[model samples]
Target: MQDRSTFHDAATPLPEVAGYRVLRRIADGGMSTVYLARQESLGRDVAIKVMRPEALGDEVSRRRFENEARTIGRLDHPHIVGIHQIGRTADDRPFFVMPHMTRGHLGQRDLAGDEARIREILRALLSALAYAHARGVIHRDVKAENVLFDDADRPLLADFGIALRRGYGSRVTSAGLALGSTAYMAPEQARGEEVDHRADLYAMGVLTWEMLTGRLPFEAQDALSMAVMHAQDPIPRLPPHLRHWQKFIDRSMAKYPLKRHHDAADMLQALERIPYGPQRSFSPRDAAAAGVARMRDLPRGAWIVLGLILAAGLGFGLRHGDDTARGFFRASQPQPAADSMAVGGAAVIDNPDDALLRAAPESEASTLVEDARRQLEQRRLVSPSDDNAYDSLVAVARIAPDHLELPQLSAQLARALATDAVRATKNGDDADARARFERIATLVQATGLADDDLARELRRDTTAALAVRIDAAARRFDREAARKAAALAGVANLDADALGRLRRQAEAIPAVGAVLPGDPARMTVVRSGDGAYALTRRHISRSEYARFAEATGRPATLCRERASVLRVIARRDWTDPGFEQNNADPVVCVSWDDAQAFAQWLGARNGHRYRLPTTVEASGSAAAVGSRAVAEWLLDCEGDCVRRKVRGSSWRRDEDSRARDGGRGYDDVGFRLVREP
Candidate 1:
């Protein structure tokens, strides 16, 4: 239906509405005013969301809003922002009451605080979504603004004004067809196609991308261009730090609804798998909810033992040092590996053109160039008094870490050195600029720098610059000498004959000699173990041509070991959507019993003896690296007394049994590899 509109000219003072006293306006949206209101009937404070008079007065839209109000009131969930009451005003405008959440949205908080906080927030959001989907409610609009916080700051999905049931929107027009922000809208939604809960997932994908990168995945000059990009353009790959989150976005923002997550609950569960920062059981409702379900199968003694173990682990982890305190502020600074800012005061680059130029198109080389420059600049400007200074230093440092004086100092130095060399060559004062270039190269290499292309360009530019200083008579000789020296300096300056010979020799060898599937390239040493099984070790091997003569041949082959290591044994938790794909890669969604049976079948297929599930310690450290990434389906044996069981995966937990399922099967994001040896 009709879009929401804000009341800019309404002069009436809203003293009371639907028996609730308005305190103040908490938020003003395009179509509604959210106020902190206190209910006179129950003497309780609640957030009263009121529609604009224009929207309420519209007959068709008002009926739809009333219907939505009833639908939202029936939904009961801990993760969902609860609805208290719905009523019409004296003037006949529909309004709804909800818990007065004072803390605000998760996006407004410091994300770098602790891993557990992030985890808790994600868990709560997902849990609420799961609850809503189970009841056939589609939020259709899940954005940061629609999410609010309880008194403790835990996330609660709010504002279902535009929500729809499975089939309610056909006569009313598609809910998201003409709605949602350009950057947050799903590709399907952007195209005005028939939408589903997957649209919410897509919005969440955009939100998560923003959360990790402090930037939107897609951008355009206008909404129309952005919509076009969403409809036709590919979703930008996440920055390095957010690579782990790709699977979530991939499933959430699949081109088609069928290709996206099965439902909100599935996406929420998958979110729990990602490692973020510190968490606490701050929400009493969440704590109560998770506890009741988990306690169903455990006996008194088992529960006691589990509690003791948890207490012991917590004590141990915190007794010596609190995890949050140890690295909270320190890790708040973005490390070399991460591309985003961890601190709030860091200067944000809003200019898109400069960013595009710095990054170029997506490629391994270009990514490295961008990353190296960014990292070097950040490293150089380790200390800055203000955000702008820090930001400026970073920009310059990326291009040249050595020259970190003024704004664009590196570019200035590089240009100055080049110009001086050119003048020296023109006037026959040949030494200075060449010496400077050489000094730059030495500094770069000594600092363990690795931008090979940049280094080569600098050398060539310096040589050309040198040419400008030499007299006419010696110019040709200087140019020739420069070219020859540049060629010999490990740059790609070989003749065609030599290149041809190298190519011919390389073509003779098979590209994959002793290569293993789903693994890296390296030399494999097959050795017989005492258990009468074959074990492989990675190693390097030289080609026969190189060994026989000093002639260039094929590239050396690497043999990676075929054997898999066991990660850990985890109990089956619940199903998660691996995203939608009309392909056979869809993982089998099974329960704990199903997983154990599958493990038995797998072992039987490999050999007669049953392969036992591993312990937490056994699956941890270097040992777990040999196991699987997806651990649920491959887990062996069930622990009868407790939820604790063995599976193939990494566990940040100590004695606590982690859960795994096949919901993430289609994901190459992370999984386990099995090997007998």
Candidate 2:
């Protein structure tokens, strides 16, 4: 593909391309023109890249355009722009549709001074390339312009198939091969020799070089001269002040493909080694880690002395309260309790380095460490925002630095914190959620999860959660709530309607049928009798129970008094009887108390008051309609509320007789409503 392509004027009405209606020209490459088009069926905008009318006759360009579609169609990856549909225009031009990326390409994005974003873009590019390569497809052009971001700023590799151009010269260096962009091409690629995935790595190096220093790695007057420079020139060196990037750049762009990192995975390892931030963590070369490795060779007495020194340093350094600890200690020095974050009795040291931690890794310590980790896991799950759990885990680390479970535990805790953070944000506890995420950021090292992947998810979720809250606040016209929501979101996603959609879905109360209307002032009167108040027609159904459970954020469980581990009657829900249940059947298994709670909740939602039927009301209803199946609840018969008096025969009784019982529960047991007006 050429560095640039020309298309019809922006104001010119674009010709219809297949099923998509071209809205406007979005991009142009040497061989094709990309236009924003509306997918009528899907009701979304897509990018449709079609071969330029002039290039339709060129077989190479035709083949390349088709190949690009085939290449993208063959792979499915999060970082790669996906092909939506492929077709030919009325003018016989091949074109394919991809999800439109409005955030533009990385080359066009102003990512200056944003190291985190640059690293993220590189990671996305390399991962996409690696995936394509593993499947025998090479991304020959890996320049920043080929990388684009979605609405959430997630980078995607675009223009996959359109770059590999063949038959550039009869002076093939070795055999039939293709060349891509000249400035970013590898030596072999520039030489028009056979190339492989390694060429993509070279291109990425050039892209990275531009990202860090805002210039191409190798500058030349013309494409021909640049290709020559790439083939024979010394790999461009990053300036002395940019030395930290020298190793990554030089190795990736090495003249010899074999001299570069073997693959994307190796490159990722090198990238991970670079310090993305401050001394937030210890790396392999950190003095403490090296000293620990050396401690394995030290004598026992030396180890004891070192341990004491570490203890002393910890005591003097970690005087601040709470989970904020800046030191280490030994096991014999009395560590904090498993549940507590405050390190109280451990012997402190003046220098942590003196702890030449020499002692064969013992299973006893391992067992204790594992036990503490299990407790930590429990704490993380039940109360992830609890700083004490983090403090406790750190205490375990100080005592047993070499414990095998530390990494796994750290990762689990970080994941739990992230999950909790997202949950809190969704629940509108923005402050708590933000705090948890900040805490999670400090512990990403423990789990070995990719820092980028976790951070991206956290940020995305936080933004969405806040967006949800913003729409909700706007609906209520609460300016303070809106302001707080906006602050948490950092920047609002005005296009977001995720919250409004949920409001529509959640606000619908449970559907109840056959309501006997009463005065709107107090409550609905289902039935009026001499015994007490009013009664409802049918019994409460499973659907009502489910709605109550969901609205109250409470799980419905069978009454524990009658439920047993040995018996199969109760497994989960109050309505589910561990067998096939009729949705219309009166809800069963819930105790009188549970029933009362549901009544209270339903009444609150409906703006009324409800409670258990009085004994008089129950008997009067049975007498009024005659006995029927489905034994129902009545107010406590006697002084003891442990057993409720139930009136009417059950479904199995087959008798129209009015009878009352004070037993616990029956399979045919159910309840009906009696209301007040």
Candidate 3:
């Protein structure tokens, strides 16, 4: 609808309203004219919303308008736009002052993967809804238009003119006196029944859906049909890209009030879990204060139209992250330790020995890499649902003996490499471990892993991370010229704090005590004599020792079993899939908690003794002793600091590494393994 025009000829600009000077019109909304005005005494800008003169002449319309102002005035919520002062013109026309907002609404022009912007918007809206619902105030008209963004880009819900408080339902206009838009109206409101906070949730669901998908769920030709769909229509499914957000969106749009999110607090928690992007700090109360100012000043029609444009723009522009623009849809447990292993993205090597033995010849590996390239080219022809092609390439990397043909591998290889590194560490192998760790740094620098800006930055930062690892290993072990070698390898000191910590840790280990066999750097192999020797050539385990101990104690046969958890660890001579068996990394799938539990179980099974997953730094330090046999593809704590990622691999994919990259990038990919702890 076109905005109402200002009546310039009606009267000369008024000097002040209750000590405020009238300025030019800033916005106009339905039933109100919002003007940008100034409080001379307070030296502040404020928005003054005035009742339409026509409505003022009608006792009923005037009373209804005044009631809205009074209802909003009584509310004090961070999310709900607040009221500062209320006054009347010489003719008794109601005017109210609220804080003035400078930032525009969420319009097509502002939506993008800007972490800060989206966070502000979500926080303000959610906070407002939460506060309003808690105090028995049900904002029947919750929509993008009704939400105002302030200078900080945080949201503030305005236009509570149509709010209905519980126990004051009688004050609400009777049936057929429709309020709120059909596009965002709740089912109860559409049915003309008693409405409550659920109505606001429905509106939020619609708003969030629009933010994600750039469209509404129902596209009816009339208001009645829309209402029908809202009340009884099946929950519409968003695009495949948005399926991951199903639970959040579905609950937000539940048919029953009780079925919807209990409140804004609950909904906001869900929003945080969805992993859109980095978040921006914002304050909703500040924005609401601004909206109040605008409402009190501009002409009603103009303000309404401006608000509509801002809302529409916001809905159109908002997206999850800077990666591929997947369609939007209507959108968390607890505090976990920073050091805990995340099993979402890592690979599991079930038989490290078998994997090493199965490594493919160089020629075969090359051909397999070729085939993977061909398959990637046909991704458009392949079902978007199928992610097998990517996995095949990863499998090739696992079986390759020399880890050659790195360029021909898929992005999945990055994950596989890390998985291999971790596995190698578990078995106490170190050479293969260092190679894989360095390989990851190189991959980030040269590969197409830079699909998104955030990922690219992360990859770049990872390069610096690798250098620090090399230096720490040398200092702790007292290895000669290690720091010089690191510099020669093109690794610079990127993080000062990390380097210092590594130095401190190295000093604590006290250069392997003399005559302690492997404690001495030069005689490390001395400890490998007799029963301690486990060959890299044979993927076999020495179950004899455990068996003998069990027999002496008369334990069960299974109790005597202590086979190598990772039967094999292999890297392809070239990138290829048939090489997966040859490659030998067992794609282990489990949560960080699950992995830790398994490690604990293993320790308990071994007579209450505990084993710990080696930190990435430790595994790298021992690379020389371990690299000859298995590569540690999945060690933790190497990078030192915890950094966040945009996309995570899925748990289902981890069960079978290939599936993890399915549909698109996933953030859950940081999956890791646990040692007997």
Candidate 4:
């Protein structure tokens, strides 16, 4: 895997090819030496993959190397690198030319942390796979190293040197020709059994899992051991956050070919069903194109009707604004002649509430409904699987429930979103799923409670999610988390037994009372020791520091580099501790001088003793075994006042974490002041 580009000068001779000039070597793969060269005839740069000198002697590998050109030439896809031409050297050494991808391979870049981008990447991947599969080409080697990209990070499949095509003669010199990268190969392929497109699908599943979680399902030190592992090992269960894809992965990577999706198209459909992430922006043109594709699948007259609807919608959209025009277009639909009861040759609007829509389709509220419909359609087509923003859709449904198809669509959306919420809950996205369910209830309400059953079910679903979380939190003895979950379940008005059961075993808390300073920081009595003097519950917060700064007119230096990207300048007061620390969190970046100043200010105002804790008081008196409560400042050393002993442990601990010496000085360090009252 050495991508060494050797320059040819006096000592090194420049390599030559048939129709191209080799500028330098780009990479060295297992069977080939890839070169960055300019195709003189085409006047463009290309990557020439030359069969390694050793590989040329092996007739089997040589034939297989030539087969790559034909395999890729037959399977032309945008996401797959295009073959320019095929040629052989004077010695009959095979080589092929392809566009030089500057961005290199997936192995050179990391994508495991980007879930949203990975899902989007998979969309393009499906398009490419479906195209290749239709042409009978199975990309046997689909590891990260074989996937190259352009400057924009759009992936292109490469190295079809070992591809297996159904109708074509494979480069299989023997019945036991070994193929593919070991770590990513399917079980059947690994075992050297007769493989099909399912092997390709298995590799795709393995690649997808690696992209998301950064590890192969089965791995071993040697090829033989790895092959055996793939054949016999049970599919590893995904983490809760990824369990939503369990069935999909299981089906795709099923050991038996018959058990997997029969074709690439079916696997693509399965991928399309997953609610990937946040809503992505899709142009109106894109929506229209998708709409046309969908309409093509419908009856002939449906396209004509669609054209008429778009015409009317555009006219209305322009005249009254996006909402009204959209509303006016749908509301203008001719009422079923027989369904509507006629009153003096005029149709009575169905449902009295929709009379406003029937009265004036040009009304702002009706327009809003129309716009809502357009938004809904775009959302459905653009992100068919994701449960995105529904505020606008719900708002318009309330105005024209009868005239527009809003009521019907709302009900369907309610059911779909509820199902998605349950799926999300199972995937451990409880907060997001709970929010989506709440939105579903709101949408149902906008439809004038048309489906009360759906509303009830949504409420039940939300309650159930909370119950699951509450039980889980309780099991982990996370009382704070359990309390929050139970509070959420209480919103649905759960009966005493169900909700009360979670709160029955109230967590024992120390009887520590708070003493509010004349300033801002609150002091709490140390329950583990005598209740004479209380240690500050937390270190001096930024708010307390701000107050100290404002009153004493002393400068509290604001931290320059803030961790919260979207935070305002006011919040960036110290070094970002890598994660979110709330207003309740102790303030960092304060020097010992700053800590003493605040303590002195509070003491002078309240006429009570306020000071840093003694070393024994911090180590013995404090209940410091929680996740990451801030480390506190201890009194200065016995003789040397310059160095102060810092006590307590944090989420990030060091070797000298408990060595209560005045040695560890830090910019983000915080301190606690104990009151001497």
Model 4: worst 10 consecutive residues (lDDT sum): 505-514
Judging by lDDT, tell me the better candidate of 1 and 4. Answer: 4
Give lDDT per model, in order: 0.49, 0.64, 0.51, 0.65
lDDT of 3: 0.51
What TM-score, computed on C-alpha atoms, does each candidate reach?
Answer: 0.39, 0.41, 0.40, 0.42
Q: Give the lDDT ranking, best first.
A: 4, 2, 3, 1
Q: Which prediction has the highest lDDT against the true structure?
A: 4
Candidate 1: residue 325 lDDT (0-100): 57
Q: Is candidate 3 or candidate 4 better by TM-score?
A: 4
Candidate 1: tens digits of C-alpha lDDT, residues 1-677? 11222343346667357567777666765556777777775577877777778775666566566656766665655567655556666666667777777776655655642545555666567667766777777776776666777776667787776676765764363444556677788777777766676777788877776666666788899998988887787778876655666777777767777877777655654664453322232598888888998888688899899999999988887866664455543324322434444368774444333343353456443343444356345542222333322334344345545542332333433344445544554454445545545544443343334543344444444333322222121212223333333332222233344334333333322221222232221212122221111111210011211221122111222111122242122222112222332222212222334333333333322222222234432243222222223332234334453343434332222332444332222121122223332
Residue range 1-677, candidate 4, lDDT tens digits: 22434443447444567767888777777677788898775577888888888887787777777777777766555688777657775556778778888887776666766876776667667667777878877788887787788767788888887787776654363247667877888888877777777788888888888887778888788988888877788888877677756777898878888988887766765664554332245799999999988867998787789889999988886877965556656665555657569899887767553455655436755665555566555655114334332654555655555656566656666677777776666456757666665766566566664764555555545545555565454333345655666555554444566567545532321134534434345666554432234677666775666666665666654432224454453434343534566555566656666778778767544435578888766654554323455566667554456666666655445423332334323434677887653
* Deviation in Å, model 3, residue 266 alpha carbon: 2.3
Which of the predicted structures, 1 or 2, would earn the higher TM-score when compared with the native? 2
Supply candidate 2's per-residue lDDT for 435.
74
lDDT of 3 by residue, 492-559 (tens): 22245534544444444323322212221122211111111111121111132223233223222111
Q: List ranges where model 1 is wrong by over 4 Å.
A: 1-10, 112-115, 171-177, 272-677
Rank all candidate structures by their TM-score, best first, as comma-separated numbers.
4, 2, 3, 1
C-alpha root-mean-square deviation, each candidate: 35.0, 24.3, 34.5, 26.4
TM-score of 1: 0.39
